[model samples]
Target: MLNNIGLPGLLLIAVIVLVLFGKGKVSSLMGEVGKGITAFKKGVKDSAEELEKSSADAARDVTPPPSDKDKV
Candidate 1:
């Protein structure tokens, strides 16, 4: 059913929304939506970076084991 809503349907919906909300209200709403999307992307990037940092931190040390002579 939704697939049938092609460009014409979308345009009609947009027209109705614009008429109901007014141009300025719709513009501000779209701006807020854009900001939300940007914030969400940044959050995802930050989360990925944090996970990478944590995994790098958890890596095993490359130094050789201590010799038996070094034992007490």
Candidate 2:
């Protein structure tokens, strides 16, 4: 069903949305949407970085201490 909405359908939808909500409202809404997307991406990146740091720390902790026989 969605695949059937080609360029004309998209244009029509845009026109209807513009008619319902004026240009300024739409523009501001788009700006807010862009900001939201940027924030979401940043959050995801931070989370990934934190996860990597935690994994590295865990790996370091898992290392065994030097044995007495190796203390020659």
Candidate 3:
């Protein structure tokens, strides 16, 4: 369905949006959307880092150091 919407269709949609919500409103809305996207990306990055750190920690805890008795 969306594949049929070419440049003209996008222009029409933009005009309609501008008319319904004035220039300032649309601009602010777009700014908020941008901020939301940035926040989402940051959250994803932090979560991935936390996961990696936890996995590394768990790996260290799972393996014990060799004892002196084993050297015999």
Which pairs clash (backbone N, Cα, C closer than 3 Å) in model 2? none
Task: Give the clashing residue pairs of candidate 1, or none.
Answer: none
- 1-72 per-residue lDDT for model 1 (tens digits): 998999999999999999999999999999999999999999999999999998887675667789999997
User: What TM-score, over all chains together, does every model reach?
Assistant: 0.84, 0.83, 0.82
TM-score attained by model 1: 0.84
Sort by TM-score, top down from the best: 1, 2, 3
RMSD of each: 2.6, 2.9, 3.3
Regions of model 2 farther than 4 Å from truth: 64-72
C-alpha RMSD between model 1 and the true structure: 2.6
Candidate 2 displacement at residue 44 in angstroms: 0.3
Best by TM-score: 1
Candidate 1 error regions (>4 Å): 60-70
Q: Kindly list the per-residue Cα lDDT of model 2 for residues 1-72, writing each as its tens digit.
A: 998999999999999999999999999999999999999999999999999999999988986889999999
How many clashes in each candidate? Answer: 0, 0, 0
Better of 1 and 2 by TM-score: 1
The lDDT per prediction is: 0.95, 0.97, 0.98
lDDT at 62, model 3 = 77
